[model samples]
Target: MGNAIHDNDSQMLYLKKRLNMFLEVLESVDPESTNLDDIDRMIEMVDDLEVKVHQFKKSE
Candidate 1:
């Protein structure tokens, strides 16, 4: 129904917003910290977020 469509749209927007936020954090990474294991983890997390977002869209 119309309500389900509206809910999905809202959730999609929220997910996109979170993606942008993650991208921003990635962009702000300090070059000096790039050598650390945590940096690798952060990059992986962003990749995972992107994959999950794509999967969510496909599911919808």
Candidate 2:
């Protein structure tokens, strides 16, 4: 049980890091100056991270 909890916590931390990185990237980009493809890719990455986080929570 302890190991499971630890694993969950680690996964949560990783997810948070990914989210922060995405946010930084998004913030660094100027909406008017950035291309649509880059914005789409960032959005997709965030979506994927969210799905992973949800899966981790469900497993716990």
Candidate 3:
């Protein structure tokens, strides 16, 4: 039981780290001077994260 909970906790922490990194990149973007390239990159990042979450859910 403890091991299972620890595993889940570790997974959650890693996910949180990914999310934080995404947020950092987004927050660093200059909204006033935003470009199509930046928009595309952000979209790609979110899409990647979405796929990861979907896979994680399917695993459980």
Best by lDDT: 2
Report the C-alpha lDDT of model 1 over 5-55, residue by residue, as the tens digit.
235677677668777877787788888857678687787878777776666
Q: Candidate 3 lDDT, tens digit per residue, 24-49?
A: 99999989999999999899988987
Candidate 2, residues 1-60, lDDT tens digits: the string is 134433766887777888898888978988788998997998898889878777787878
Q: What order do you get sorting by TM-score, best first?
A: 3, 2, 1
Q: What TM-score quantifies how close candidate 2 is to the native fold?
A: 0.76
Cα lDDT, model 3, residue 47: 92
Which is better, 1 or 2, measured by lDDT? 2
Name model 2 segments beyond 4 Å from true.
Answer: 1-6
Angstrom error at residue 26, model 1: 1.4
Worst window of 10 by summed lDDT in candidate 3: 1-10
- The lDDT for every candidate, in the order shown, is 0.71, 0.79, 0.77
